[model samples]
Target: MKLHTIDTGFFKLDGGAMFGVVPKAIWNKTNPADDKNLCTWAMRCLLIEDGKRLILIDTGIGNKQDEKFFSHYYLHGNATMDSSLAAKGFHRDDITDVFLTHLHFDHVGGAVIRDGEKLLPAFKNATYWSNRQHWEWAVNPNDREKASFLKDNILPIQQSGRLKFVSAQDGVSFTDDIKIKFAYGHTDAMMLPLINYKGKQVLYMADLLPSAGHVPLPYVMAYDMFPMKTLDERKIYWNEAVEQQYILYMEHDPVNECCTLQQTEKGIRIKDLFKLEEM
Candidate 1:
């Protein structure tokens, strides 16, 4: 199996929202914010080439939204979904599965594309993967998360008859070497893919752990529905990551692509940081 980092681009999000209760004095040291309190973040995606299946995890915020909508989150960078795919000698049609960790606009936006007036699935021949519970929650989003779950980015897959719901069972095998782990704190039933690559396990840190800055226990995102739940989940996973020596594939970290945790006197902290290709 081969894994490639598909960088769609970078966007700015409020640092305060990204670092929950963590003070700016603390988080600023890692993710510095601009005058507007917005910090730049990478909308990094992952491509998995396993035998006959080419699976893509998370489509970074697509370029379909209107000017007014995009003005809110400044999307910048030369890398694009198509360009990144082409770099790997692949195309959108080459993808067999799009495994969405959640339905947030920034994560699933590129799943669909704007074709004139109609919204369509970006991966024409690929089956869009989502879970039943998260699908329902995203479609009928609560007021707090409504803005993040855009209909243009989601409904098209179901409308196109290419959407499939994976089993909600935790640790369920999505493929022979890929297992799905579910976390609820970030959003309802957010799916994290645990992939076995080169005889080692790699955990896709969707929003469960957005960046190395979030390695410390209290650094939960304000966007999480249940911050306390996230804390508990982190404690459990952090220890497992250290014990099992799992490589964490980060989605939103601008500089760091992957990292491993080490047990310290305080708690679990990053042992080393490196790119996925280094593996």
Candidate 2:
């Protein structure tokens, strides 16, 4: 089995929103913000090639939104979903499965594309994977998360008849190497893929921990619906990761692609940072 890092692009989000309750004086030490208080973040996804099963973890915000809508996020980057895939000698249609961690616009927006007068699955050949719990929560979103769960990015997968649910059971293994770890602080049934890569465990740090800058337990994102739950989740995962020597594959970290954690006086902190190729 092999793994590929697919960088969709980068976008800006409010620094305050990215770290709730954590003051700028603190978070800015890691993720500095612009004058407008917006910090740049990458929408990095992962592609796993396991025999006949090719799984894509998440897609970026995409290009279907209007100018006004995009202006808000300040999308900026050269890498894109298609071009990045092509760089690795793969194509969208080559994907066999798309395991979405959640249905946020920045995560699942690229799952669908605009084709003439109709919307359709971006990877027509891929069976889109999402858990039943998150699917229902995303489709029927609450007011706080309604904006993030765009209909065009989501409904199309189901409409295209390519949607599949991950086994609702936690700690389940979809393949011989990839296991599922569920977290609810970010959203209901947000599944994080735990891959046994190169004989080492690599945890895909979804929204539960978006970036390396968020490693310090208190740097929780305001976007998380349950900040306390995120704290507990991180404590449990980080400790286990450090104890087991797990590598963290960050999804939204703009500069760092991956990292290993070490127990620190300031709680869990980065032990070493490097590209996946370094593995």
Candidate 3:
């Protein structure tokens, strides 16, 4: 199986919100926000080429939002979903599966696009994969998360009759190399894909660990509904990652694409940093 890093684009977000309780004095050294205090982040997606089945994991925030809506996030970057895929000699229709880690706008926005008056699947031929529990939670999001679950990004997949839910429970295997791990803290039933690639195991650390700076256990995001639950989830996942030597594939990290954990005296900390292609 061949794995390719598909960089959809980058956007700016409030650094304080991204790091939650962590002080900017610390996070700034790593992320370094702009004058507007917005930290640039990459909406990095992954394309899994396992034989003929071309699966694109987590489409980045699409370009359907209005100018006023986009003014808030400040989306900037030369790379886009279409151009990035074309660089690798493929197109959206070549994608057989759109595996969404969660329903957040930045993560699943590219799954659907606005086609004049109608909203439809960006990949008309692909089956959009999302868990049943996550599907329900996103469609009826609470006040705190409502903004992230945009109807334009989500509802269209179900409306297009291309959405599918995996019956496989938590820690369930999706394919011979890819396994789905569930984290509830970030959002309800956020599925992190643990993939085996080229004799190495790589965990797609969606929002659970958005960037390399988030490798430290206490660096949970304010956006997480249950921060306490996130702490526990991180402990469990980090321990396993350290033990198994998993290469974490970060989606939102602007500079660092991948990192690994080491058994530090304080706790598990980043042992090394590199891009996915470096591995």
Candidate 4:
């Protein structure tokens, strides 16, 4: 199996929201914010080529939103989904599965595209993957999360009759070498892919662990539906990651593509940082 890092580019998010209760004075040292108090982050996605199936995890924020909407989050950078795929000698049509970690606009936005007056699935040949629980939660979103679950980025997959659900069971096998691990703190039933690659296990840290800077136990995000749940999940995952020596694939880390954790004097901290290709 071969894995490629698909970078859709970078976007800015409020530093406060990304770091939750962590004070700006602290998080600022690691992720400096711009004059607007927004920190730049990468919309990094992962592509797995296993046998006949080419699976993509997370579609990044797409380009269908209006100017006013996009003005909120400044999307920048030259790398696009198509360009990144082409660099790997592939195209959107070559994708066999799109495994969305969640239905948030930034994560699943590129799953659909605007075609005339209708919104349609971008990858015409790929089967979109989501879970039943997350599907229901996103479709009937709460007031707090409704803004992130845009209808334009979501409904089209189901409407196109290409959406499929993985079993909600934790540790369910998505493929012979890939397993799904569910986290409820970020949103309901957010699935993180655990794949066996090149004699090592790679864990796709969706929003569970957005960056290596968030390795501290208290560095939970304010956007999480349940911050305490996230703290608990992080403790479990961080310990397991250290014990199992898993390479964490960061989704929003602007600089680092991947990292490993080591038990530190304070807590689980970043041991080493490198790119996915370095594996």
Candidate 5:
């Protein structure tokens, strides 16, 4: 099996929201913000190539949103989903499965595209994978998360008859080597893919741990529905990651792509940082 990092480019988000209760003084040291306190973050996606099945995790924010809408989050950078795929000698049609970690606009926006008067699945020949719980939650979103769950990005998959729901069972195998781990704190039933690559494990840190800056225990995101639940989940996963020696594949980290954890006196902290290709 081969894993590739598909960078869909970078966007700016409020550093305070991304870092949660952590003081700007501390978080700024790692993810320094701009004059407006907005920090640039990568909408990094992953491509899993195992034989004929090419699975893509997360789509990043697509280009379908209006200019006014995009004005809010400044999307910059030259890399895009199409360009990144072409670099790997592949195309959108090459993808067999799109495993969404959640239905947030930034994560799943590229799943669909505006085709004139109609919104359509971006990957014409691929099956879009989402869980039943998350599907329901996103369609009928609460006030806080409503802005993130755009109908144009989601409904098209179901409407196109290419959407499939993964079983709600934790640790369920999405494939022979990829196991799905569910975390509820970030959103309802956010799926994290635990992939076995080259005899080692790589955990896709989708919002559960957005970046290397979030390694410390108290660095939960304000966007999380249940911050305390996120804290508990992070603690459990950090300890297990250190014990098992898992390489974390970060989705939002701009500079770092991958990291390893080490148990320290205070708690588990990043042992080393490197790109996925370095693996």
Candidate 6:
């Protein structure tokens, strides 16, 4: 199996929200904020090439949103889903599967597109994968999260009759080399892909660990539905990553694509930072 980094460019989010209760004074050291207190973050995706399947995990915030909508996020950068796929010698139609961690706009928006009068699945030939729990949670979102779960980005896959659900059972195998690990704090049943590649285990850190700076405990995001649940989940995942020597593939880290954890004197912290290709 081969994995490729699919960069979908960067967007600015309020640093305070991203860092949660952590003081700007501390987080600023790593993810420095602009005058607006927003920090740039990457909408990094991953591509898995395993024989007949070409699975693209988490499409970034799409281009279909209007100017006013996009003006709020301050999206920037040269990399895009199409361009990134082209760079890898593939195209959207070539993807056999679109595995979404969750249905948050920034993560699943690119799964659908606006074509004239119709909103449709971006990858016409691919089956979109999401869990039943997450699918129900997103479509019927609460007030706090409704903003993040846009209907246009979602419903289309189901409308297209191409949406499929992965079993929410934790550690369920998505393929011979990929296993789905479920987390609920960030969003209900967010599925992280635990992939066995090149004699190493690479766990896709969806919203669980957005960046290297979030390695430390208590650095949870305000966007999480249940912050305390997130804290507990992190403790388990972080330790497992360290014990198993898992290379965490980050999705929102602006600079670092991957990181390894170490049980330091101060607790589990980043042992090293590198790109996916470095492995």
What does candidate 3 score on TM? 0.98
62: Cα error in model 5, Å = 0.4
Per-model TM values vs. the true structure = 0.99, 0.98, 0.98, 0.99, 0.99, 0.99
CA error at residue 92 for candidate 4, angstroms: 0.5
RMSD of each: 0.7, 0.9, 0.9, 0.5, 0.6, 0.5
lDDT of each: 0.95, 0.91, 0.92, 0.96, 0.95, 0.96
TM-score, structure 4 vs. true:
0.99
Q: Check candidate 4 and list the clashing pairs.
A: none
Which residue runs does candidate 5 get wrong by more than 4 Å? Answer: none
Candidate 6 residues 140-212, lDDT tens each?
A: 9999999999999999889999999989999999999999998989999999999999999999999999999
Model 1 agreement with the true structure over 1-279: per-residue lDDT tens digits: 999999999999999999998999999999999999999999999999999999999999998999999999999999999999999999999999999999999999999998898998999999999999999999999999999999889998899999999999999999999999999999999999999999899999999999999999999999999999999999999999988999999999999999999988887899999999999
Which portions of model 3 miss their true places by more than 4 Å? none
- Clashing residue pairs found in predicted model 1: none
Alpha-carbon deviation at 147 in model 5, angstroms = 0.8
Candidate 1's TM-score:
0.99
Candidate 2 is scored at a TM of 0.98
Error (Å) of candidate 4 at residue 267 is: 0.9
lDDT at residue 274 of model 1 (Cα atoms): 99
List where candidate 1 sits over 4 angstroms from the true fold: none
Candidate with better TM-score, 3 vs 6? 6
Q: Report how far residue 232 has shifted in candidate 2, in Å.
A: 0.8
Off by over 4 Å in 6: none
Please give, for residues 1-279, the per-residue lDDT of candidate 5 as tens digits: 999999999999999999999999999999999999999999999999988899999999999999999999999999999999999999999999999999999999999998899999999989999999999999999999999999999988899999999997899999999999999998999999999999899999899999999999999999999999999999999998999999999999999999999988888899999999999
Q: Where's the lowest-lDDT run of ten residues in candidate 5?
A: 148-157
Predicted structure 1: lDDT: 0.95
